[model samples]
Target: MEKIAITTDYITLGQFIKFIDVIPSGGMVKYILQEYTIYVNDVEESRRGKKLYPGDKILIKSIGEYRITKQ
Candidate 1:
């Protein structure tokens, strides 16, 4: 799994997606969420506003797995 280091206590799913360069802008979050199946700690997630903290595991179907960590 790839590790994503963040300076904040938490980050929104939409922001995370952008941080990972999955989308060009925040406005594309909705479209990407609708196009892919994302799982947060084994639970299916669709909310762009979903808060993700350190130690959280994210699985993006057909993309790759990622883990959140503190910088």
Candidate 2:
């Protein structure tokens, strides 16, 4: 699993955009939500603003996968 460290207790949707560097601007989060291109804790999450906490596994299709773990 690719470990992604959380620098804080919360991260907004806009911040998530940076983490995913591949998706084109303006349609990144939308694409993920609409296409079910992401998974949280092994389940697909369609909410663009889905708050991710520590110990969550996020799967981004085509780009890669991330396992969020607290420091």
Candidate 3:
């Protein structure tokens, strides 16, 4: 379980870009979304700008499961 520190209560699309270790940055997310290569809570997430809240799980095939948490 890797922890991503977030000062804000919710994780925004822009902020998530900083977490490149788990997922690629910039156009990468867009590419994934366009290809339906991402999932949120088991459902295929096509919105690259979707906000992730605390306890929310964003799953990428290459990165596995990443849990969003508030710091």
Candidate 4:
């Protein structure tokens, strides 16, 4: 799995998606969330505002798996 390091306690799903370059802008987060099937810690997630903390695992079917880490 790819590792994504974050400096903060948590990052919103939308921000993470943008940070990974999955979408062009934050405004597209809603659209991308609807188009892609994303899982967080094994649970299917759809909320763009979902807070992801260090050690969280994310799986995006069309993309790849990722693990959050402290930066």
Candidate 5:
């Protein structure tokens, strides 16, 4: 598991994915989101614009776990 600090109240899933280096670019994030399953707070999430807040846990298939924190 890894911890990520967010400077804002929330971050979009696509932004978070890129922030964590899960995907190389914005164009690829949509494709990756559609191809794989990403869990937000233990629920399957497919929306690229899904909002993630502090303490949210994201499970990206084959990528690893990421926990969010407020900075």
Candidate 6:
């Protein structure tokens, strides 16, 4: 598991994906999100606009887990 400290009220899934370097481009992000599953606090999530706040845990299938925290 890894921790990603964010200084904000919330971050969108797409932004978070980019912030974490999941995929190289925005187009890739869309494709990856469709192909893979990302879990938020143990529940599957697919919306790119899904809001993620501090303390939220995200698990990207076949990749890794990330815990969001306040910076």
Q: Residue 33 error for model 3, in Å?
A: 2.2
Q: Which candidate is the best by lDDT?
A: 1
**Alpha carbon lDDT at 22, candidate 4:** 89
Model 1 lDDT per residue over 1-71, tens place: 99999999999999999999988888999998999999999999999999999999999998889999999
Give the better candidate number (2 or 4) by TM-score: 4
- Candidate 6 C-alpha error for residue 21, in Å: 0.7
Candidate 4 Cα errors over 4 Å, as ranges: none
**Tens digits of per-residue lDDT for model 2, 8-61:** 986554456567565567456676566647777888777767788887778877
Model 3: per-residue Cα lDDT over 33-60, one tens digit each: 5544667767777665678888877776
lDDT of 1 at 28: 94
Regions more than 4 Å wrong, model 2: 24-27
Model 3: how far is 6 from its true place, Å? 1.2
Query: Looking at model 5, which ten-residue stretch has the lowest summed lDDT?
Result: 20-29
lDDT of 5 by residue, 1-71 (tens): 89999999999999999999877888899988988889999999999899999999999998899999999
Specify the poorest-scoring 10-residue window by lDDT in model 6.
23-32
lDDT of the candidates, in the order given = 0.96, 0.69, 0.65, 0.95, 0.93, 0.92
lDDT of 6 by residue, 1-71 (tens): 89999989999999999999888886777887899989999999999999999999999999899999999
The whole-model C-alpha lDDT of candidate 6 against the native structure comes to 0.92
Q: List the residue pairs that clash in candidate 3.
A: none
Which of the two candidates, 1 or 3, achieves a greater lDDT against the reference?
1
lDDT by residue (1-71, candidate 4, tens digit) is 99999999999999999999988888999998999999999999999989999999999997999999999
**Once all C-alphas are superposed, what RMSD does model 2 give against the true structure?**
2.4
Q: TM-scores of all models?
A: 0.97, 0.72, 0.70, 0.97, 0.95, 0.93
* Model 5: pairs clashing at backbone N, Cα or C within 3 Å: none
